[model samples]
Target: MTDIPSSLEDVAEACGTRAALALLAHFEGIDLYFPHNPRPDHPILQALGPEDGPAVCHYMAGETVTIPNRSPAKRRARILALHEQGLSTAAIARKMHQTQRWVREVIRRAGEDDQGDLFG
Candidate 1:
């Protein structure tokens, strides 16, 4: 679960994985402004609560940050898991915020034999 995107590496290193993931989940694909002096009502604070909020503030005070919405490896794993669970490509696409073609492609790619694995 600590497998955070590289963009959030500094935050994850500074604050820990839970905090970084929380930030990612809440603020992915959006530019978020973290105030130097975060008020009690700041969204970061509200989302992360007392334990992690100040840690993030201490790390990146007065910064505007955008967490990436997609982690390629994570997305692939999710797609495969959904596929294994008997979800249709269209349903998986809708659920994962991806196009059906993309879902199908991931599914197809996952089933391909890995050339490198033969040596192992």
Candidate 2:
């Protein structure tokens, strides 16, 4: 019998019930490609010594290839604007939508009242 490489496959193979639950929690209602802004300070990325971080591969509307950060609030806001236009969640879901959960979240965030301004 041959021993497996511990580094690559060990973490995945050792993902027991707790790990599975954690994975579900981490990914639930989140887009892997377009994660929420301000990632939770990834230690690994920091440890990589900061050479502009990992490059993401993305395909844009014009079929152009681009690498973008996980969270681009400008683009997200554009999608939110559409949601605020009385468009159905499904409609918004079809357009800029990556996931239904993400669409709903955008709508919810857009609908929030400007309470912050009142405090100021």
Candidate 3:
């Protein structure tokens, strides 16, 4: 099953998990062109900031990369797992590069799903 994770494993190895996840969070399902020599204002730099941007751009210089899409079920499962691990909604959102409201909604929906059919 293809997902954001599998797609980014190589990038994670090349850079780091945080940088890869940052790319996924910012540019998923988009085609990003990495210039051979990028300026400070490059989109990748903009997304990953100064700390990670240079490394990623250096690794992928002169390439047009197609960022993968996040699988919904996998994403939900990950959210649940992180929540189970005692990470707060804000932490999960930061780790997953999502909004706290979105994380809360996912948790709430998972709870509803776990309850099953009430009238059945």
Between 1 and 2, whose TM-score is larger? 1
Best by lDDT: 1
Give the per-residue lDDT digits (tens) of candidate 2, residues 1-120: 022222213222443333323322333223333222324465222322233212111111112212222345764786778876887767766665356677787667766754467556
For each candidate in the order shown, give its overall lDDT on alpha carbons: 0.83, 0.41, 0.82
Better of 1 and 3 by lDDT: 1
- Backbone Cα, N, C clashes tallied per candidate: 0, 0, 0
Tens digits of per-residue lDDT for model 1 on 13-87? 888989998998777655778888898988899999998998898789878887777667887899899999999
Two-way lDDT contest, 2 vs 3, winner: 3
Scanning candidate 1 in windows of ten residues, the lowest lDDT window is 111-120
Return the lDDT, model 2, position 37. Answer: 31
Q: Report how far residue 61 has shifted in candidate 2, in Å.
A: 21
Tens digits of per-residue lDDT for model 3 on 1-120?
133377677778888888888998897656778787788888789999998899988888888777876776787788899999999999988777567898999999988878968699
Pairs that collide, model 3: none
RMSD to true structure for each model, in Å? 7.3, 15.3, 6.9
